[model samples]
Target chain A: MWKKSSDRFEYLQTLVTEFQDTDIEEAKEQVLANLANFAYDPKNMEYLKQLQVTDLFLDMLTEENENFVEFGMGGLCNLSMDPECRDIILQNSGISLVTNCLSSQREETVLSAITTLMSLLTPLSRSEITHPSILHCMLRFSLSESPRLRNLAAVFLQDCCTEEQVAQAEQQMQGQQTAVGIPLPQD
Target chain B: MAAPVGNSSGCWSVPEVYKHHEQRKVCISRPKYREGRKEKAVKVYTINLESRYVMVQGVPAIGVMTELIQLCALYGVVEEYRPLDEYPAEEFTEVYLVKFQKLTSARAAKRHMDEKSFYGGVLHVCYVPEYETVEDTRLKLQDRRRYVIRTAQNRAREKEKQERSNEDPTTSDTTTTTEMTIVEYDKTCDSDNTGEAQQTSYMSHYSSFPPLPLPPQEHNFYGHTNQQGNIQTEDKMGTLHNAIINTKQQLQKSTSFSQNSSDRDRGTEQRVTPNQASAVRFVPRTAHLENRKRKMAKEATEISLTDVSGKNEPLIGPKLPEPPKLDMEDVSLNTTVSLIRNTMKQVESVPDLKPLEKKIKPRRRI
Candidate 1:
């Protein structure tokens, strides 16, 4: 058991290093995606935390490459499922970074962002997560054409916030809406 | 902005095939250390990419829809199914939409049935999130989130328990007290882990205490079926026996296929079992069949004996032995005996005994 754990840790460390050292965009994306997928398994959570892969994922949010942002958000979405990882993300100010991806053109990135936001909820972070602008973003998502996005956003509203908050957000949405989740036109 | 590649529409429209439905090229250039158990495309799966609704294409249009659905039911309860008459299909092949009761069932079906041949055609299965109502999507995400949290919480408690056991040997005597303290600690420190903790401090909030880990054998009960789906070999009583138990489970779901495939499944099991290091003790198929036949014959006699006694018992006294008394040793046999007894009593109690006996006597004679 000890040997296997170490082997897994080492394998993850290799992926992390390859992700950093590789200049090829495709290899980086592949490694990023592999690490994100590994984050899905609970057994790897401890090793990922130890390797500071959480910070690695957080850094990708600010990258110019959209794939980096999407995969990074996806990793965070998986990692934040664990309470410890959620705390780590909260400490790192992950909400704003994730919240930034709410407006990403890619639906997958937006979906991951919303889930990550829901997972990042704690007594301290709940207010920030359900802040009116984010709530407004979720309200927009709730009306999305895609059923997956609309359903996920609906869950975020229903489970992570109060009916009063939702009603207030709805009332406010009619007056002045933030483009927090609205797509910006590309050149 | 690129239109997101998955289910980008609602349920009421013509199901447009999405980009995710196409199988991507497998990644082969990975260095030796990173290859998975199966070669896979470099794709990340988030909850958005999965759904309880799956679309299966490339079914041979040979009017074998019943067989196709029977194959699907082996994975889980197929909630609803209909052939997608308007959707595009490969020349001479058809497409069908299947809604599973659970996303996990759909996932299992896709994993097991995709690329498998049925009626001379291979199947290509992919999630059709486009077909989900908003409620379906909500429940799917909620369930996935809850499952992940549950598994995480269980792992956390297990780690804490191990740490406590290792930290002090004296407290081992007061395991219940130690557990209580841990639960107390969880309530105080890990309050955020429970989604409801901030809402209300009800006693039910303490139910998050980890369930006793399932026994190793019972692990198969919780949908670890796929992991153990492959048949194995065990040297019971020093003979190379074919263990086609998992295939038996699949066969039990669709009995029509069981007749021919029982032997074929056994052959597959033996062939798949790697490396017979023991001096190749080849047990003849006929011998195995004979052994099975003898055991079946013994069971048949036991069943017949119970049936005779069940009918001879008068209605007044404890109307058939306590269910335990009718135990046929196997659960399935016991169930069958109870069913027979119940029907027999029903026949006796109703004022229709003569006609019932007339119907039953011909079958008994046969």
Candidate 2:
């Protein structure tokens, strides 16, 4: 079962690419294939650690923005939690392209793109700074009127900053700054 | 600026300095960069035309702006705007007709006039707004745009071209200096050797300048009159003839491009020339300046070389004079991409004789 699980990884990627523009049933096959390959396979564990997973996740960034019904925000969340995918998200230029999708029409698409961006910054210094300009652009987007945007920004701001960086920002804010969610963990 | 005062010699001696004031403005307040609000903010661009530098948009002139604005609007930034009064439908109706017309033809006169006044107002609003209100600021930050094609069509008026190089003429006449930039290009690639690029560059100058006698004269007068572009008008031989004439004129401008190239030097055109090159004023652009210059220079160099050679050979396809670089010869270039860099070899002459036909042939193949 474990050997069979890893063997299907290529098929899963193929399914994701092929059905990316397809209907709900076809997309479920893609997700199930990925979940099985990722969750059940043990012999393929080392393969799971490679940058190829990142390439696969990054490919989803270009998937039809119209197909949220197929691979929705959940797909984005699943990829974010994966370490290999997370590292790639931080390093790849395509991650910015995903974050850029936050400006997309669908709320789910926007949320997922933002979540992926925020996820990279969650484990601080895990990757080199993807882009300083993008971070500033995201912050600019966070000031938006969309409640979804506000909540995502709030969550991202809480999870993203390192303790030392936040401390400095706090000091700069002086006594007037109000507290937000979880403060950065002390090293 | 000096005001001349009559001194002992009876000739007005200008005072070098009056009440000296610094030329820079100090901004006391930053415009409200409203954050974290669905509140709209304007992106303002101020272009100091500086009498010489060209207005810049990006690729494909009008097309780039349309794409950029369309994408932005699709993503829901702010409403991308067209200039307050672009062309009235009537006059604009004939644009397709004029499109076929050579750019330098008389047909472009009206369209160029409209675009000038329209762009000037839009540029002005972008630079300054009297009111501090966001609306006022937004109005000022009209997101006005202009595109600068990589080609030579970036020149402005004819006089501007003449005046630019005419400011200094010594460097303009030298073929060695003209060859310097071209020679610097890496040779060895068949792509670079196509010899068509030179023709395009020459023709590009013509395309950019295509005689506009009206816009400079219009001076802020944009009247609305819709003419041409009806079903009957589209089929007329007269329209086609006019377009071919216009295109031919643009081609002529290409051949005579040297006459006005110095004029275009003020705007995006100068972006091509080094600052030092700008000081070398050439004659007003004329058709075939490049051909004449290249032909003349080759003749002079061959004449000098013929005396050294024992036998007389036609200058045509004569062994290329070893250019400035001696080290570059026989350096095995790694790839086709790298070969374009070795421009010191016998750089082929440009070739694109019939641009429309070439442009059309590709679509048929596709």
Candidate 3:
């Protein structure tokens, strides 16, 4: 069993190395997919951590390639549940990177980002997560057309914010309503 | 922005807080104790039993307060209903917090109404706990949501781990080694070789057959068809030859006139020209035409036989005598006797039916 795990680790190490060295988008995508698959197992967390795959995923978040962001967020979402992985992500400012992913057009990327945020939520990081802009985005997301996004945003709102804060936010929204221009006529 | 800042200040604004508190007065509201005025405290009325407040989830996007109240009224008297409108209009449909007149009704609503489909979504109805405010409920929901997500993640991870561990150690090690080697090869291979490497790797994973050799570029089009045509022609010729030989032997053995005709037809069709031995490409088309012609001839024979039989048969059959009438009275009597006997046997078998019949007959007569 130990040997099997070590072999798997070696395979993952090779993949990560290939991912870094390969300039071909397709090869990078394949390696990212494999890494993401491996990331789903908790037992592989030690190997992944040893290989510093968490940093690799974090790096992919800022890539121009949407697939990289998607697979990266997926891996982070899977690994974020692990305390060690969570700490590494947190130390690497993964919250901002993940928060940036909310604007992603890809639904899966957005979902993985949301779940990763949920997984990484700590009392200390609550302020950063509950920043006004993030809160506003989540509030809008709570009304999203997609049920998954809505429910996830609702969960974020319920879990992350207090009622007082929500009410306060609502009141702010109402007050800002009047400051904007006049309402346009509806068709 | 001004509104949020104003609302933030409104939290400290005593009158606004009071106004907000006023809306929930009919429902159970937590009382505030006077700090200094312990002596001669005024009497307060509080319902001793649990409050009739129910939190109803899964409201449809277009649902209104009245519709919710009407739906809840089926179980009990809904005193009031308020849809939580904290979310923006675009974000989510409103979820209702309903208050009933009685605790029994609230409990009944929770039991019968919970998890029922409201519109397109399932309803989640439950009594509001005494101490948990909306904020606390949200917090609890958040915690439950986290727990659920974590559990799901753990389950997925455990399943993947189990799958990995269940695999044969030797095979998995070899597979990993091969996969690593392929990845390494892919890295070292030039762009032109990358496609071939990928194809080879894919074949290695799924198939034992060696990767097929690429066709020469000059012969790409006809190369495939030439191979296919040769195999097909060889199969068709062998089958046709065997069939012809068997039919000819059968014809030599048969003494029937129709068999003789069919044998002549077969012999004419089977007469090979000088080019027939090398005419593999033309065989399939000629064979198809011969088969069709034979089918047509058989169909014509069948049609002629059917027509001759129809011409020889009469158009209508001779009339027949009517069936005898049943003796209704005798049949009814027999059935009644048999039914009574069956019932009597049933009564004898189980004596309990006798007393039941006795009570039932009296009631019927009365």
lDDT measured at residue A36 in model 2 versus the true structure, 0 to 100: 26
Residue-level lDDT tens digits of model 3 in A6-60 = 6765666667667767677866775675577566545566667666678778878
Cα error of candidate 1 at position B297, Å: 79
lDDT of 2: 0.30
What TM-score does chain B get in every candidate?
0.46, 0.17, 0.22
Candidate 3, pairs of clashing residues: A143-B91, A172-B3, A172-B4
CA shift at B147, candidate 2, in angstroms? 52
Q: Residue A59, candidate 3: how far off, in angstroms?
A: 0.3
Per-residue lDDT for B99 in model 3? 55
True contacts kept of each: 0.17, 0.00, 0.00
TM-score against truth, every candidate: 0.62, 0.24, 0.36
Per-residue alpha-carbon lDDT of candidate 1 for residues B1-366, written as tens digits (9 for 90 to 100): 111123333363566666678988988877776765567787777777787789999999999888888888777656567788888888999998887655666777787788889899999998988677655665455445445554554554475467566776653433443344345434433332234432232222223211111111111123423312311121111111111332232223222212212322232232223312221232111223433554465456435434543223211212111112223457676566667655654644431121101111112110
Candidate 3: segments with Cα more than 4 A from true spot: A1-3, A181-187, B1-366
* lDDT of candidate 1 over A90-184, digit per residue (tens): 76667767877886777778888988887777656767777766776677666654567777787677667777889987765443323232221
lDDT of 2 by residue, B219-317 (tens): 221111111111112211123344344334322322232222222233323433342243223211222343355446546753654454212212221
TM-score of chain A of each: 0.91, 0.51, 0.92
Deviation in Å, model 3, residue B256 alpha carbon: 99
| CA RMSD, predictions in order | 29.6, 34.6, 37.9
Rank order (by DockQ, best first)? 1, 3, 2
